[model samples]
Target: MDPFEKMSLVGLRRYQAIVKAQLPIAFSHALEETTPWAEKALERLQKRENLVTEAIIKLEFGDDPDLGSQVSRSAAEE
Candidate 1:
């Protein structure tokens, strides 16, 4: 973004042939940088899925079974 902004300031704002040419390369680099972090987050969620589900169930059905059932029914309908 900083490089693109520099290019824009250096050249015409309305038409940036250089920026347009480099957009895909820049986007690819950005995705490459973040992909690992995203993958790790997804892996962590997958690993903890059962524990998270148990926590949610406990919270939902803690004190009121009727309310929990209503919520479950509404969510199912949706």
Candidate 2:
């Protein structure tokens, strides 16, 4: 076994290389083994992002909008 792997400490370059090398392998395996799970995760994330965008749009331009004014006031105070 490599000395770094045997111990808790690794050189910075070695650590970076290890991470860089493993990312593709990990992603490939994840894509192959967890297609449905990955798709569900992505869909959930997209739904969350859409909800956040809608909320932000409402805050910026709705009838009872207050966050924009609050942000501008805070910036002016600063």
Winning candidate number (TM-score): 2
Model 1 residue runs over 4 Å out of place are: 1-15, 35-78
Q: Could you give candidate 2's per-residue lDDT for residues 1-78 as a string of tens digits? A: 322333222343444345545545555655777887665655554444344333443444554557656654564364
Clashing pairs in 2: none
TM-score between candidate 1 and the true structure: 0.26
RMSD of each: 18.0, 16.7
Error of 1 at 75 (Å): 42
lDDT of 1 by residue, 1-78 (tens): 222223222243323333345545555655677777655654544434333332344454665777766765674465
Clash count for each candidate, listed in order shown? 0, 0
TM-score of each: 0.26, 0.38
